[model samples]
Target: MADPNWLDERELTAWKQFLSTGAAINRLVDQQLKRDAGLSHQQYEVLARLAEAPEGRLRMTDLAGAAVTSKSGLTYQVGQLEKAGLVRRCGCAGDERGIVAALTEAGWQKLREAAPEHAALVRDLFVDGMSRKDFAAFAAGLAALHDRLNPPAI
Candidate 1:
């Protein structure tokens, strides 16, 4: 009898493809962002998240949640950004202990400069490779997996 715990051939293939494709995409995106924008992928993500928040700022905890990073990891990245003058950290008014990360004008300018080329790279490397129908199905599958892994807090 076959081992029930092992992936079947199709499942194995899909898993391998998912790992390899994700790694390859991450490497390429990281390289491109570093080369063109002088920012790491994580830093860019932080800036983007802050830019989306009210007043271009968010509490550190909320920002960590939005960025899917640990508090320590976010703190490290925020430190780096602060050193570069791309982000500023301030005490939250409502909570003395709470910290907020606010994107500086420099950060906004950096994101604006980086976004167009970043979008083009994404489209070229990933989006353009798949047909619209296939891309939609792929996106739906990923979204379903995300939802399953991160159920809403009731």
Candidate 2:
């Protein structure tokens, strides 16, 4: 016999809306960046992560984790950024085998210029449509789910 946990109509609608919203948000952000700054959404994420680092630098492995991408995928994306002169690889001061990825001045400038438009896109796509209280509850719920799935390291 088959399991009986199939989604009801409301659940199905919510699931489909989630998927569609996610895809549409991605497409909007990607298209905006590509049109205005010539960067893909993934590339923008790499830059954002580097910009978040102290001294605008992070170890490649840390960058991969922060960007939620595989090591090989991060390497490929970093290589592309390097070729575009947006980021640079520097030797780790203490570890011979570790390398730091640093966002260049050009990268910082690009991010600054793109930020306003990117933020507007986010607002237009989602934030403006939601109630602040509902959004907060939604974020908190997702955080709880994430903590449950990936518990604190102990």
Per-residue accuracy of model 1 over 36-141 as CA lDDT, tens digit each: 9999989999999999999999999999999989999999999999999999999999898999999999999999999999899999989999999999998999
Give the per-residue lDDT of model 2 (tens digit) for 1-154: 9989999999999899989989999998999999998888889999999988898899999999889899999999999999999999999998999999999999899889988898899888878777999888878988998889878778
**Candidate 2 segments whose C-alpha is farther than 4 A from its true place:** 1-4
In candidate 1, residue 7 scores what lDDT? 92
Candidate 2 has what TM-score? 0.89
Predicted structure 1, TM vs. truth: 0.95
Task: Provide the lDDT at 16 for model 2.
Answer: 100
Q: How far in Å is the alpha carbon of 69 misplaced in model 2?
A: 1.5
RMSDs, each prediction?
A: 1.9, 1.9
TM-score of each: 0.95, 0.89
Point to the candidate with the largest lDDT.
1
Error of 1 at 66 (Å): 1.1
